[model samples]
Structures are given as structure tokens and as C-alpha cells.
Target chain A: MAIRWIALRIIQEIIRDRRTMAFFLLVPIVVMTLIYYALLEDEKAKLGVVTRGVARFYEYPLVSVIEEDEDIEIVSLDIPDKETDPAELDRLIMEEMKKGKAHGILYMDQQLLSERFAGERGAIHIYLEGSRPTSTAAIFSSIAEAMDDLTETMPVVIDAECSAKCANSVNIKAIEIKKHYLYGSEDYRLIDYFLPVFPTFFVFFFTFIISTITFQRERVRGTLERLLIAPVSFSQIILGYISGFIIFSSVQALIIIGYILALIQISFTPHQLFALGVTLFLIMIVALTMGLLASFMAMNEFQAIQFIPLVILPQIFLSDMIWRIESFPLVFQWISYGLPLTHANIISRKVMLQNQSLWENWPQLLSLGGFFLFFMLVMSLVALKRNKNN
Target chain B: MLKIEGLTKRFGKLTAIDNLNLNIPEGLKFGLLGPNGSGKTTLLRMITGLIEPTHGKITLFGKWTPTSRMIRRRVGYMPQQTAVYPGLTVSENIRFFGRIYGLSGRPLEDRLNDILELVELGDKKKEVLSNLSGGMVRRVLLATALIHNPPLLILDEPTAGVDPVLRLKFWDWVDLLVKQGVSIIITTHHISEAERSDQVVFLREGKIIQQGKPFDIMKRFQANNLEAAFVRSTNLK
Candidate 1:
């Protein structure tokens, strides 16, 4: 009955509260739809390519080029020693590369223009720096195809003619490669990657929404005093609250998971579902801890609301929703590991997408559980001490 | 019954309740009257276990130190302000505090009906606290404090902003609670209400300047009203 009454109050409190409605129910779905459309649905990757003699070939009808005003940030490094310069100019170019001012550099040797080189054995030497690997690969493939077209017009040399044991090496052969998938096809889009994170994201959003606003309201409304005086021990109250939110957050998790699986057809392994369950549970605990901390710090609801960007934005970014930890610097990986959501992401991806077992993830599961328990203990103590002192 | 000995509370350099002591047996309506900063609320808060007195012993019903939950269940506290949830309806607010005291079902419903009638807020039970008038909210706060039928009731300022008609009715309700063996501790500036108290303790600067039956104290000060007597006592100090 106590749980039911409190749950009813929690429901009523959220339903009547406009900010609560906005943050929990509306924001997650809005952001998810927007992110899905902004990143995956009909979105094109923008590349800045710097070309030397490969421009005409790149403009061919078979190539897909997405042109913006700032497309192809071309930088010309016209020098004999462009790749290995010892001059101040080379230092400046290296600085630009380090500062992300240049994506790729291509140097075309003037020897290609000579009529002597236009006959049987002449070729254009392409010196391309392959950093900014994606752009480099794109440019290299396009230029290499164009160069292959140039090579078609010239007579081929047989350098291995004296090697009698390899006489069939001169015989031309064409190989065709075909690819197939057993589960997710090659067309398994970017949302497949984002699908795993949506559960974590939604859980985080709802937990944060429910805990922060409710706890802040308790503090501001002065009913916290009433609770302090009640027969319910502070720890019990905290425990009850944590349990209540966990119940609600689990529902939220199931809802989002169902949506992704049923409406969106995102494949998730049972282990991944288990990992997601653990993640949602951990997120609820983190939310309770954050809410208690926010309750202690914020003087009003507006101040508590300010914690959303300060708290949630970093979790979203560092939890590998859009970026991977290995792709980040070493220092960032350590920082991401320190975040609860990072563990959630690891466990969820491993279990859901990779089909890993729970026992194998005991280390992460224990760490997240330990963090929640430690926080619960600390928060309960703080709440007790604060109520005793206030 | 509540008992205090050598009760002392200090906020940094300033001592709020300085080595104080008081005792109120069951069924006694005790008044803790004091000027601003005289530690009236501070003392009530300590008794309710909201704040701990640094140097004193507090015994609730002969227990040396009462746990918060135990004292909270039996002792009703109405803070100086209307501490009810402004968003909740009056009956809902009462029901919340009632459930905190472990009251529910038919008993809780009956108690809710009784308290609303006691506070003369039967019609406003469905009204949100924020939507109610200040007087109505104050009455509802008193109703909340009394919802559990606690043996000890402390009203920080139960009659503030209340019209004289309701103020008289409020005291009459206190009298009824007293008749039912419930102890009452009230703080107020209304001398006429203080006159009706079973006992009054005048405090100044965290010290009890005078304490006795209200008419006796008035007679001792040669004043016709409790207000003049309070002024005389403070002036003498």
C-alpha cells in the first residue's frame, strides 16, 4: 500500500508537472527521431578532397560527389621536396595538417608533362599523403582508377620474361569477388549501430527526468521535512525511491526496446538484452545518485534543470553513442571508463550486438553494481546527516 | 510527555538554545512564547528530532534519546509556515502525512474526514493548497499535524493570519485534543490565545524569562492582558 500510494503520487506529480512531461516523455523520442534523420535517414557524407591531376576523372558521371560551398578544401604544395621538406614552408604545412586545416595533400611531378615520358615507359608519379585515412582512401581509389585508364592506352612491358619457371605469370587473369551475409545484410544501416544505444539513451533520459525533478520538488516544497519526520527511515525512503524509479525505468527500457525491435526491426541478441537490462538498472542507480546530489546542491527546480546539459550531454557523448573509445585519445578512454554509461555501452554492445555471455562480463557488471551500491550508501548517509543537522 | 535537560544548540558562534531545560507531562498544553530569534522554532525542531541539541538530553515518553522515526510517528509538528504541498489537494496533503503515520484504509479515510471537520475545512478538502486562501491553508496545515491523532501536537504558529472567529475555533479544537489526553505546544503572538493555554513559557534571547499560568503571570505583572505582561517581562529583562 505504501509503495502503491507513493507510486500514485509519483505518477500524479509527473503528470501534472509540465517540465517533467517535457524532459522525460517528449525529449527522448524527439531527440531520437531527430538524430536518426540527421545522421542516417537520407544523409550524405561530406568530403573535402584536394586533387592534382585527378580532377577530370573525379567529375565522371559514375562518381557520387556531394558538393557544398566548402567542398574540396584544396591546398597546393608545389615543390620538388613537398613530402620531405626541411624548410620553414614545410613546417607551416605540417602545422596546418596538425590543426586540421588540410585533409590530404597531392603532389604531381612535372616529369609527367614531358613528351619523352609520353611514349612506352613514361608514367605520372603520384605522391599522396594518406593521413585523414577516409578521405585519403576515397581520393586514392578515384585517382588510381583514372591512372588505370591512362595505363590502358600504353603497351605493357613483360619484365618477367627471363623467369622460365614462371612463364604463366604473364597470362592475364580476372578475378571477381562476391559477398553475402547470414544475419544483418550489407544494407544494415547506421540505425543498426544507433539501435543498441537508444535503450541506454532512453533509460538515461527518463531516469534523469524522474529523479531530478521529483527530488528537487521534494526539497523546494518543504515536504522533505515531513518525510524526515515520518516513521520511514531515510535509508528506507531512499531505497524505496530507488526501487520505484528502477521499476519505472525498466518499463521505459522495455518500451524503447520493443519500439526498436517491433517497429524498427533492429536485431538484438538475448545477451545484449541482458546487458541492456543491466545498463538500465545501472542508469537508474546513477540517476538516483545524481538526483540526490542535485537535490543537495540545487536551490530550486530551475537550478536542478540546469544539470541536464552538464550531466546528460557528456554521458551521451562519452558513452559511445556516436563515437568509439579507441577512436578517442588515451586520456579520454580513461575518462569514459570512469563514466557509468560507458560500462553500460560496453556491456550492451557486447551482449546485444556481439552475443557475449553475462558471466564473461562479471567485471563490468560488478563494477556498475558496486558503483550504484556505494552511491546509494553515501547518498543515504548524506540525506540522513543533512536531515539530522538541518 | 516530553522532557529536556541542559538542551543546548549552537549555530557557529551564537548559541540558540543555551543550556535550557523544560518538562511537559502528558495532557498539558504548553506554550513556548518568545520574540524573534528567541529559539522557539529551534526548540520545537529539536523536540521533533529535526535538529539535535548539542549539550542536552531529550526524553520522549521516558526514552533517553528518541529516534527520528519513532518521535515523528507520535509527535505532530506544524512548522511556522504552511508546509503542505501546494500542488496537492487539502485531503491529499492530509492523507500523505496520515500515511506517514501508518494510517490507511477505512481508518485513514475516517481520520481524514474527522480532521477536515475539526479544522472547518470540509468544503475546501478538494481544493489545492495553493488555490486556497492563506487562512484556509493555515487551517489545513494544522489539520495535517493532527491527522494521526498524535499524543503530542506542536503548532509553531497555528493561528497566524486567521480571522478571530477561526482563531477561537482553533483553540477550541486544541481544548478538545487536550481533553483527549493529547499534549499541545503552541507558539503565537496572540495574547488572548496564549491566555487560554494551560501553561505559558516566555522566552527572550534563548532563555526562559518567565513561565506560569497566563492569568497568574498577568496578575504578577499587574497587567490586564497577556500582551502587556509579556512586554513588562521583556522590559524588566
Candidate 2:
């Protein structure tokens, strides 16, 4: 009952604070929306569709969808009817691809469009620029969908598979994907890769900041001393802070994840969403404890901000949230071994993508739980020591 | 209710409190009078167990070392700062501090009303502490301290910055507490204010230069008032 009241009081205090409410509840979504558009939104994929059948290509049903995509600039290069050599047409497309002007190319067989071959099924060839694998993959799939629309009359051959000689094989009717995903389906987008980890980062960052400054303010305003003189124990105080702040932090994580999902349309099963929510709660608990421990060292709000560089930045730089962790050097990689976010990022991604349970991801859960317990113990010690006015 | 002997707190070369000895018995209104940096706060902090003494033998209620929780609950301490939560309303702050000291339900609500009446904050129960006047916030602080109804009340400079009318009201409540046999220990630099205590001491550099009733100290120093008596006691010593 006592712990409940303390927790309730803290929640009431934070809810009543307008500045804190704006930062925790409002700032994250606004900034996250900006980041979603800036980093993940694909507004500039260039695919060169090579075909003398310029008018025929516009007949593709998905052409309307493709045209509405302002991110992709489709420069239709005209080959001179059946008179132009097929090899010359493909060579021109490859030339444009090498210049990096087009990330992908679609070569429509001129013979298939001519009257002589009109009775026979036409074939289309897609060539993807090799520099950026993800962008190359996205453009390839988009063209595949466009050909899937035209597959009833024409056979589409990817650049790597079945050369132009096999394009007219009337036996095969539909597009065939030679490679399959071991994880997500071919329909997955680049934004899907980060859905799991971004939620964790958002939760950790906001919770760390709000918890630190608010705890420091408790000391600055002298309420900490007053609390010390109460019958409340140190452990109870830490528990109260955790219970108080975690309620809102969990809501923040869910709100961000839900908003991003609605905007980006990444489908998740109820089980996956639940796992994400649970993992976020665990990470938020870690952030809360870590923040309280740091607050003990800070005498003022500015000193609390000093912890951002000292702790938060280092954790972010070393974690997989920024980039692939393997790209980091040996010493820097070793730093991530100690940082709990590394484990959290890995675990959240696995849980959301692989549908791993708490037991399946026990090692990561143990590491994150260990960090949580370690910080909690340290926070208790710090809170107990600092309770007495110095 | 309190005892001290050889109580000394030294910050390296600087001794903040030195060889202080005093006894504050039950039902007595005691005051420690000193100028700024005269170790008044340090002395009060040590007694409240907010900070441990460097070298001292101290006892409260026959126990030389009370458990931390006991020390917290047995003494109602109101510091000079407005320790109430500024974001919380009067009723919320009252209930919060009361809950912290293990008060709740009917008894808690009753004490909240009683404390608001005592502090004369009966109408401001719904107002946030930050929006309250300085004197009102101080009253809220005192209400929180007194919420648990601890026998010993230690108010550190309670009326220091409060308006004159509020200070008089605060003293009137202190008189009521004394009549109820609640042991009260107050610290202040206001010599005239310290004169009303049953026993008062003027400390300098952590050492007691004057210890007696206010009138007796005035007679001993041959001064017309406590301010003059206080000036003579510290300067002469």
C-alpha cells in the first residue's frame, strides 16, 4: 500500500508537469515521424525500363501505381522498333545502369511486340544495378509486380535467371523467383528491418532522459530529503520510481511502435506485438534504474544533462541501433558487450521477426535482466547513501 | 528526548561543530540561535540523523543508535527549504507525506484536515504548492512534517522568510504544540524570536557561548534586548 501511494504520487507529479509531459508523450512521436520520413521513406529509386514498346509499357496495369511513386523516376529509353539489335538495346540499358542513373533496368523483347511474334508470348528482362543491394532488391520486386500484371500475355525473365533465349518459352506462364527468404517474405520493405529495434531505442532514450532529470529535480527541490525522513525504505523508493515511470514509458513505446506501424504498414501478429511490448517494458525498466543511478551523481538539472554524453550517447553508438554492430572495431565491439542495449536490440529483433519467446531468448533476457538487477542494486545503494543531506 | 556530549563535526581543517553538549527534555521549547555559518544547520542536521556526527555521543529516547526508520518516524523535521512537491496539490502533498510515514484511510484524512487547520491552510488544499505563497508553502512543509504526529518536532528556520503575520501564526501553533507536551526544537538566527523558547543557546563556531533562558542571558550581559545580549555574548567570548 505504501509503495502504491509513492508510485501514485510520482505518477501524479509527472502527469501534472507540462514540460515533462510534452517531452515524454509528444516529442518522441514528432521526431520519430520525421526520422521515419527522412531515413526509411524511399523517395528516389530510379529504374530504367528499356523497350521500343513505349506505348505498350504504359498498358501495364500497375503503371498507374508506378507513376504515382514520385520517389522512382522511370526514364523510358526507346529502342528503334524491330530494326534495333536486342543486344544493343540491353547494352544501352546496362550503360545507363553503370552510370548509376538507374538502379534497375527492364528490357522488353522487341520481337514479342512485332506482328511476326505477336501470336507468341512476349518476354521482358529486368537488370538491377549492383551497388546498393536493398534498393536494387526493392526496384526488382516492384517491376516483378508490374510484369506479374502482364504475365498472362508476356513472360518476364529476371536478368540473372533464364536469358533472353528462354523468354519466349511459352510453357512457363508466370514470374518465378529463384531465391527465397529464410526469414521474412519477399514482400518485406526496408523499414521492416528496423521496426523491432527502433521501438527499443525510442523507449530507452525518452525514459532515460525523463527519469534522470525528474530524479535530480527531486533532490534539487529538497523533496528527496523530506522523503528520506519518511518511513519509506530505499528499496521501496526505487521500486516506486520504477513503477511510476515505467507505466508511461511502456505507453510511449507502444504509441511509437503503433504509429510507425500504421504509417509504414508493417504487419505483425498479435503474439509478435505482445513480445515487442514485453521486451520494451524490460528495456524501459533497465533505463529507469540506470537513470536513477546517474541522478545520484547530478546535483542539478544541467548536471543531469551532462549524463547524456557520458552514458546515453556511448550506449547508442555501440549498439546495433545505429548500424551493423559487426562493422565496429574490436575494442568498440567489446564496449557493446558490456552495454545492455546491444542485447536488447538483438533480442527485440529476434522476437519480433523470429517469434522467439522469453524462454527461447533466455540468454539475451538473462543479460538484460542482469543489467537491470545490477543497475537496480547500484541505484538502491546510491539512493540510500544520498538520502542523507550532504 | 535528546542528549549530546562531545559532539564534534570537522570538515578536514574546519570544525563545523565542536564539543557541543546539550539536553532537550520532553515538553520543552528549545532554540539554537546563531548567525549565518555559525553551525546552526550542521547541529540540527546531526540531531535529525540526516548526517552523522564526526565525533559525538548522542542519545534519543534512551537509544544512542536508533534504526534509520525509527529515527525518521520518531522525529518530525521541517527544514528551511520548501520540501513539498511543487507539482502536487495541497491535498495530494498531504496524503503523499502522510502515506510515506505509514498514514492512510480515515486516520490519514483526519490528520490531513487537522494539519491544514494547524497551518491555517484549510482553504488551499486543492492548490498546487508552486502556486502557493511562500508562507503557505512553508505551512504545507510543516503540515507534512507533522502529518505522522511524531513526538519530537525539529523545525529549522521555519519562520525565517515567512511574512510577519504568518510567523506570528506559526508561533501560535508552536505554543499549542508545547501545551500538548510535544517536544519542539527550533533553530533560527533571529535573536528576538529565539527569546521565547524555554531554553535557548547562542552558538558561535560550533561552541555554545550563551545557554539559558532569554531574560537571564539579557541580565547576565546587562543588555536591554536579546539582539544586544546576543552581540555581547558572542563578541565578549
Candidate 3:
């Protein structure tokens, strides 16, 4: 009965606070939408083609075919007489990339053009701006397609009139680029690669903030003291609060996950989806316990909010959500290991992207459970101490 | 019934309640009156088990240190801060407290209405607590304290912000509850309000300066009112 009332009051309070309600439900959608557009892959790649006595390569039918077929914009650059030095040409390419005139520069010099014509091996150098990797990759692939086209059709063009000796030396063969995906498909974009982290991150963040503030309000307003004086045990009160927060936090998680899946059109099997849900639920539980424990250290709502940087931001930066934990130093890696979000992110990515089952991620789930239990125990001890000191 | 012996509470070097002792009989309206910082609320908190005493013991209903579930169920505590959910309506707040105290169904609804009517907030039961006036909020707090109908109700400054007319009504309700054998432990700064209790204890710096019936204290101090009696007793002039 005590748990029911506590949970009911929490739900009512959150529902009635219109601003908090919007923050809980709508903020995630807005943030996810902005991130989606921010990380979206560009459809067109612009290339600056720098040629030295190989400008005729740009006029080939195959180059035009690739330009039209792959949605690539190829701009031809004339090599100045003074730019004959490779260092000067490199400076010119860097300048073009810095000016945002192209995503990448494709440099095909006289030696490479002559080698292609003479049926010998040739290498084309491509310089990338390196800031926008997705577009740079598109530019690189478009140029590679054009080169492959040239390789395939060069033999046919020479076979009509070349002698048998020239034909025998023609070793220009198209590099067969067979693609395989170990995890995701070739059509997967940046958003799909990152979709699994969004729901977990946003849910964890917002739930933590809300729980901390709400619990702090209870303390400041003396409702917590009143509860402590009531017939309910201390553990029951904590359980009640946890159950209370879980209701809305779960709803928030569902909305975010559903919105991402629907908006990004990512597909998962029913079993994989269930595993993902379980992982998210565990993350939500950890976030709630974390918030409750943080509230114990804070005296008011402002102080509770102050905990975001101390408590939530480190998890975001170090949790392997944005960066790989393996790349971090040993100390930071240990910190990431101690954080619950790190485990949640790992489990989420595994369940969603790798199609791994929940049982396969038991260690991470157990770590999350341990974090939940630790937070609950510490929060209870704090409550008891505060009660005694009241 | 509640009993205390050598109840002393200390915070670091400052003693909030210093070597105090008292005995409150059942079915009596007991008042602890003092100015701010005199430790009236601190004494009430110790009795309600909200805080631990550094050097003392509290016996409630013949049980020493009544932290058990049975003792908790028999006691209802209303802290000084309006400790009710501001976003919830008055009835919702009462209902929540009722449910927490193990009241439910028809009995809960009936008691909810009874407490709301008793507190004279029946018309405002649907109003959100934050939208209500301060006095109405206080009334809502009192209503929640009374919702479970505990044998002992400890109210810390229950009528602090209530209007004169509503304050009188609150006393009348307290009188009715006392007549029904409900033991009341109330802390208040209003000396005249303490006159309504069966016995009042005036605390000065955590020590009892005066304890008796209102008229008897007034007679002993040769003052016409309890406030004047309190001033005379404490030499506050």
C-alpha cells in the first residue's frame, strides 16, 4: 500500500508538471532529431580533380558516366606551370580542401596516365579533407569506380588495333571489390550505427535528472521525513520510490526507442528486440538508483542539478558511447568500467547490432545489477543517518 | 501515552534538547510551547522518533524507544513544513496518506471525506495544494495527519498560519478528538493557543521553565493570560 501511494504520487506529480512532462517525453525526440540530421550522410560528393598533362582523363566517357551515375561532382583543376613541383601541388590540394571547395582531391599525374595507356600498373593519389569522413569516402569510392571503369574498357579499346605482344603485356585487370559486412549492411548510415546508444543515453540522462530533483524536493518539503515517521520501513520507502520512478522512466525509454526505430527504419528480430528492451530496463533501473543516491548528497533541487556534470557528464564522455573504451588510458578505462552506462552501451550495441542474446551479456548485466544494489544500499544508509539526525 | 527520561540531544557542541524529561498521559492534550530556538520542535521530533536522542530514552505506549511498526502505526506526525505534495489535490494528498497508513476502499473514502469535512476543506478538496492559500494548505496538512485516525497525533506548529476563525475551529476539532480519547502532542509558539491544552510545558533553552494547567500557571505567575504568565515565568518582561 505504501509503495502504491508513493508511486502514484510520483506519477501524478510528473504528469501535472507540464514543463517536466515535455522535458521527459519531447526533449529526447528533439535531441535525437537534431543528432540525426547532424550525423546524416551527405548524398553528393564533390571532388577536385587535379591533373598534370592528364586533363584528357577527365574528358573520358567513363569519367562522365561515373560522374552522372554515382552522384559525384567532379571539378577539373589546371596545373600551373610553376606548380610542377609535387610540394607545390600538395599545397594547392590542401588549400582547396581548406576552402571547402571539395570533399577530396583526386590527383592523376602524367606517369599514371601513360602507364594506364601503356598497359602497366599505375597508382592514383587521392587527398581527403579528412573532416567529413562519410563524404570523403563517397568521393574516394566514386573515383575508384571511374578508375575501375577505365581498367575494364581500356583493354576493349586497345584490343581493336593492338598487336599480339601489346595484348599479351596488358595486365590491367579490374580489382573485384566484393563487399561483406560482419555486423551491419553496406547501406547502413552514421545514424544507424549510433541508434542503439541514443535511447539508452537519453533515457538514462533524463531519468537521472528527474529522479534527483524529485527526491530532493521530497526532502526539502519534508515529505520524506513524514514518510520516515510513517509505518513504512526505510527499505519500503526506497523500493516505493524506485517503483515510482521506473513507471515514467520506462515510458520514456519506450518512446525514445520506438521513435528511433521508426524514424531510422532499423530492423531487429523479436528476440533481439526483447534483449534490447531488457538491457534498457536495467539501465533505467541503474539511472534511478544513481539519481536517488545523488539526491541524498544534495540539499536542494539546484544542488541536485549541480550533480549532472559530476555524475552524468563523465558517464557520457567515458562510457564508450562516443569513443571506444579500449582507446582510453588504463585509469580512464577503469573509470569507464565502473560506470553503469558503459556496460549498458556495450550490452545495447551487442543486443541490437550484433544480435547477441541477453545471456551472452550476463557479466555486463550483473555489473549493472551490482551498481543498482550499491546505490540502493548507500542511499538507504544516508536516509537512515539523515533520519537519525533530523 | 509517552514517557521520557533524561532526553538530551546534541549537535556537535550545541545541545538542542538538554537533559529534559516529561510524562504525557493518554487522552490528554499536551502542549510544548517555546519561542524559536527554545527546542519545542526538537523535543516533539525526539518523541516521534524523527531524531535520535544523544543521552536519553523515550518510552511510547509502555515500549522503550518505540521504533517498531505497531508503535509507528499508532502515531501520526505532521512536521512544521507543509509536508504534502503541492501538485496533488487536497483529497489526493489525504488519500495517499490514508493508503500509506493501510486504509483503503470504502473505509478510506469515508474517512477521507470525514477528515476533509472536519478540516473544513471539503469544498476545496479538489483544489491543488499549490493553488490553495497558505491557511488552506495548512488545513490540508492537518487533514492528512488526521486521515488515518491514529491514537497519538503529533503536530508541529499545526496552526501557525491559520486565520483566527479557522484556528478556533481547529481547536474545537482538537477538543473533539481529545474527548474521543486521542492523545495530542503539539508544539506551538503561540502561548495563548497552548491554553486550550489539558497541560502545557513551557520550555526555555531546552529546559522546562513551567508546567501545569493554563489557569494554574497564570495564577502562580499572577498574570491574566498564558502569554503574560509565560513572560513572567521566563523573566522575558
Q: For each candidate in the order shown, give its overall lDDT on alpha carbons.
A: 0.68, 0.75, 0.78
**What TM-score does each model's chain B reach against the true chain B?**
0.95, 0.97, 0.96
Could you give candidate 1's per-residue lDDT for residues B1-237 as a string of tens digits? 788899888887888888888888788888888777898888888887777777889999877765656666788888876678888999999998898789999999998999998888898888888898888888888888888998889888788788988888888988998998899999886765788898999977778899999989999999998889999999998
Q: Which ten residues in a row have the lowest lDDT in candidate 3 chain B?
A: B228-237
Query: Model 3 misses residue A227 by how many Å?
Result: 1.0
Which 10 consecutive positions of candidate 2 chain B have the poorest summed lDDT? B65-74
Model 2: per-residue Cα lDDT over A135-251, one tens digit each: 557666676666555655443343324556666544334443233232455556667766668888888888888888888888888788777667776678888998898779867
RMSD of each: 13.0, 13.1, 12.9
lDDT per residue for candidate 2 within B126-169, as digits (tens), equals 99888988888888989988999989999999998988888888
As a TM-score, model 2 comes out at 0.72
The estimated TM-scores of all candidates read: 0.71, 0.72, 0.75
Highest lDDT against the true fold, candidate: 3
TM-score of chain B of 1: 0.95
Comparing to the true complex, what docking class would candidate 2 get?
acceptable
* Candidate 1 error regions (>4 Å): A1-185, A246-248, A262-265, A269-271, A327-329, B123-131
Candidate 3: segments with Cα more than 4 A from true spot: A1-170
lDDT of 1 by residue, A1-390 (tens): 999999999999878866666667666674564344334323111222222343234333212322321223334333333343324433444444444444433322233323223332333332222222234444445445544444443222233455566543332211111121212333445456567768877787778777888888777766777677768877777777788787778877888988878744456667567667777787678777766776666656766886676578667756667654444546655777777777777777556644567667777888788777777777767766765565
DockQ score for model 3, please? 0.50
